[model samples]
Target chain A: MNPERMYDALDRITRVRGVRGAMVVSAEDGLVVGEAVMEGVRGNAVAALAASLAARLGRAAGAAEAGAQRFVHLQAEVGAMLLMPGADGLVIVAVTDQHVNVGLVRLEMQRMVEDIA
Target chain B: MKARVVEPWLLAPVERFVRESGARLTMVMTPSGQVLAQYGFTRAVDVMSAAALGAGIAASTGEIVRMLDEPDFRVLNHQSAQHGIFLGRFDSRRGPLLGLVVYGEDTSIGLVQLFFEDFVADLEEAAPAETPRGPVLAADFERDLNESLATLFR
Candidate 1:
């Protein structure tokens, strides 16, 4: 996808209430394709961690005889991470607060993935 | 892969970096091409050759940056179809150190760079106080080089 479109998608996701950042990252290499992050958010670090986690989850799914992972949600004390795997080894990641609307974020992320594919 | 370091303090940080980054090959050296630690090298000759080339590249690039009147780049990366090479510089109590890494398709530059930041911090924290050393004579240079190589490979 074009850079403009990618940024637009990330912007839309980050506009969600409680979302700290959104990024398009490469699942294989953990590099940021594009991002819309708030100040103090380390985009590269988030991309790396999200990609690594998605890759490991993909492996675990394969081992369990499950199909490719469509979505992943990781919850922590203060924040949460949501990932949506897309085609061409790309993944969409959202860093959000604990109170963020997970359903809304997931819906937008799915739309972004579909747009990429 | 096991990491060998000429300085005992380097062993822990280098080994941790190799394990976390999944780098196929790594070499930690000074700007003057003196090897401090290395991993994934079987031959002494290869280690010397790589150290020389890595230091040369850093020097030439640094000069180029000076000519352009730009700030020195923190890291240099060369990505190919099959592998990627990363060379980064970090400061420690001893002096500036250079880390050269070669990684394959299994790992990405982002991951390597991410772990590299931690590695540099660990090294900086672990580095001992620098000791004064006499200048190397032409005759002793080769001997010192060979001894360092022996320590790394052994």
Candidate 2:
């Protein structure tokens, strides 16, 4: 996808309340394809960690005959991470605070993935 | 795989990095091409060749960055379908150290880079105070190189 469109997608995701950042990352190598993050967020680190987790989860799912992973949510004490696997080895990742509206965020991310596909 | 280091202090950090990063091959050397530690290389010739090429790439790229008047790049990566190579530079008590890592599809560059930060920190903490050595003379160059290689492979 074009850079502008990629950013637009991320912008829409980050527009949701409590989302610190959003990124399009390569699941294979954890490299950032595009991102829209706040000033203090570490986009590179988040992209890397998200890709790693997605790959591991995908493998685990395959091993268990569970088919492909549709979504991943990791909740921590202070914040949360949400991942939506997309076509062509791409993943849409969103970092959010604990108060984030998970339902809305997931809905928007699903839309973004469909758009990319 | 086990990592062998010429300097004792490098052993723990290099070994940890090797295990954590899942790198198929790795080498730690000075910017001038002196090998300090290595993992997963069976042949001495391959080690020396990789060291030479890695140092050369770092030097040439550093010069290119200088020409552009840009800040030095922290890490350089090249990825293909099945494997990736990561070259990073870190500052230690002795001086600048370069790390070259080759990883397969089992691991990604992001994981390697993420662990490399911890490796650098461990190395910095473990490195002993610098002890100056006499400049390498033409006659001693070959002997020193062979000895270092022997230490690594032995």
Candidate 3:
């Protein structure tokens, strides 16, 4: 998938009421897909870390007798991380603060996942 | 045998904490698409009814990740101009998530985090006998996959 398209989606998520920044990355190689990140926030580190987390979760779920993992999320003290598997080898990530509505975020992401897939 | 079932008692208390703190909603979902429990404001639609919605959210928008020393702690907090949310991993200690959501008006996020720690403790203290049932088993999933494989084999 095009990084530009992913970035556009990230930008929308960041624009949501309480989001601080948003990013998209390739979880396969830990590469930055597109980033509209904040200064204090390390966008690359976030990408790599998100990729790693997604990879682990993916592996764990695949190994489970159940099925594959749909996605992975990590939350910090002030901000949060959202990782979404994309078409081919990409993953989408969003970093936001506490004001984001979990329901809205989920709805929006489900739409994005369909787009990426 | 199925793994021991998990109780969602944490939903009531955590929801109370989030609503009392003015948070719009709170939810906990497994890495997979299983939504364990959710409390707070939700649309009448069934979208908010499922548990894996959290994983769906995470996969949709990849973002900030903080690795805590304690295991089983995956938290995602996002803020919109009008609302705010904090979603985290189920606190293994408390048998549910140590999550708290606050919305409307600018809140002291730092202070809310402090309260999260306390809320976690409270959940642990109020641990119930069983957690909610995990995600559903898609009975047709394996059959579908097998059918696809059979076509390729032919």
Candidate 4:
């Protein structure tokens, strides 16, 4: 995958309305391979959290129907965590305002995932 | 072959079940935001986007209550005069969260949870043996719902 281009795409995405920042992480390692955002947003924490969340969601759940999870979203009153798959060993992370146009954000994030993949 | 490619086969049935359950939108996701599949509403505003928002809530909530011995999730079910939003956690290959939104007042919480549980079981049992072939995208699984949602909301 083109790391540099991915960073550019993330920067552009996070710049959209209500987006605070974005990160590109290695889902397997929980490592913050790249990040772009405002102050106070911990890139590492986001990466680790995303990785952990991915692991928890991707590993195995008894109730999970017979299929792979397409994506996971954790919503908070303050903000939201947006996780989308990247190429092997990677995931796209976005922290956005609760009121942001979620549809637009999702489309952009999905577009980015496709581009990176 | 990219084993993880997202495809419609993984999403169609889930969508049908969600709509049949009376939810305006239903999203099957990983705990982190990877979308397993979705049903109901297709527009950009459909469940796929909402799952992104909801999954974040589940994770943050899961972290805070883990101290209290809650099992890694905070199911948020809010009911009022107008609408209801029910959130719960489900584990597949990876344990993901499921969110269901009822547009109008539909207080059958028991039914909602049961429906979710049933689908989760089906997903686990029916999971494709070979890893999917392609980098999975949320849209691939959410196409019908996205279209439906757009039509409804518009």
Each candidate: RMSD: 1.9, 2.0, 20.3, 21.9
Instruction: Give the per-residue lDDT digits (tens) of candidate 1, residues A77-111.
Output: 99999999998889999999999999999999988
lDDT of 3 by residue, B45-85 (tens): 33233334555555443333323333333556766677656
Each prediction's whole-model lDDT (CA): 0.91, 0.91, 0.55, 0.65
Candidate 1: the clashing residue pairs are none
Interface RMSD of each: 1.1, 1.0, 13.1, 15.5
After superposition, candidate 3 runs with Cα above 4 Å error = B1-154
For candidate 4, lDDT tens digit of each residue in B44-143? Answer: 4444467677877887878888878867674677766776677777665543445545544332443455455566677776665555446446676466
Which candidate would rank higher by DockQ, 2 or 4? 2
Error (Å) of candidate 3 at residue B35 is 53
TM-score of each: 0.92, 0.91, 0.41, 0.42
Judged by DockQ cut-offs, the docking class of candidate 4 is incorrect
Q: Candidate 1's residue-wise lDDT over B10-92, tens digit each?
A: 99999999898889999999888889999999999999999999999999998998899998746999999999999998787
Q: Give the DockQ (2 decimals) of all models.
A: 0.72, 0.69, 0.02, 0.01
**The 10-residue segment with the lowest total lDDT in model 2 chain B:** B136-145
lDDT of 4 by residue, A11-70 (tens): 778878999988888775466778897898877666765776776677554257646656
Error of 4 at B65 (Å): 1.9
